[model samples]
Target: MFKRCFLTLVALSVFATVPASANGAVFDMGEQMIEISPIDGSDYYTGSANAQAQVQNTGGIQRTSFKQAIDSLEAAEVEIREEYAVYTQKYNEAKGRYDVAKAECKALKNNIKQINNRLKNVEKTKKMIFNNMPG
Candidate 1:
């Protein structure tokens, strides 16, 4: 079970270390909203509401923050796809390497699909947020 725990930690580290920064820039959300999270190495959003509600609360910074989240999601999608490709190729090449065990490969494919679905949801959220914003 050490292997399982180790793999879980590795997987979390792989994705969590990637900050969702927009063009390597940080957002000035506020002191209360910008705490650094020890678990993910990201700015921990302290608000009780969802991203849209939080955006609404931020008022003037809504558009930029929404765009930043969208960009971060897109970056994550790309990174997930890159990792998926490597595993897919390995799976195709030998069908076994211990590193790309059959079950692990299947899990990776599922993760890739999940990331794609997440991107779609993010796009939909962006549209909804944009439409609701006051002109």
Candidate 2:
């Protein structure tokens, strides 16, 4: 009788320690949501559908499936690609303008150099003419 009572007590204690429900509670933390489920040492998923429904009903917490997440990422990638293309076009246009401006500046510098050389030649000719004149 004592052995049977001790065995029953141990069995009750073990069962009592186990949680009654495997589905956990979800906590809404303002921007994020967290779900804590009791690990029942089983690979079976019992609450995935319910969790998905809850996620859909709740607008703030976005728990998406793998496919949905991938689709969203792909959409974002396409948008980024379009933006990159636009920026690349703008950069090419700016580069072309810069090249044109740089060429103009180089031409201006060459013209200034030529003018200085001509001025030096004129000064030399004037000195020669003055030396030939009397007094």
All models, RMSD in angstroms: 40.0, 23.9
Q: What would you estimate as the lDDT of candidate 1? A: 0.82
Question: What's the lDDT for residue 130 in model 1?
Answer: 100
- For residues 52-117, write the lDDT of model 1, one tens digit per residue: 633345655888899999999999999999999999898777855664787898999999999999
After superposition, candidate 2 runs with Cα above 4 Å error = 1-64
- Could you give candidate 2's per-residue lDDT for residues 14-63 as a string of tens digits? 78766443223222342255466688857886564544433346443454
TM-score of each: 0.28, 0.51
TM-score, candidate 2, is: 0.51
Query: What overall lDDT goes with each candidate model?
Result: 0.82, 0.82
lDDT at position 114, candidate 2: 100
User: Once superposed on the true structure, which residue ranges of model 1 sit more than 4 Å away at CA?
Assistant: 1-58, 96-135
Alpha-carbon shift of residue 40 in model 2 (angstroms): 32
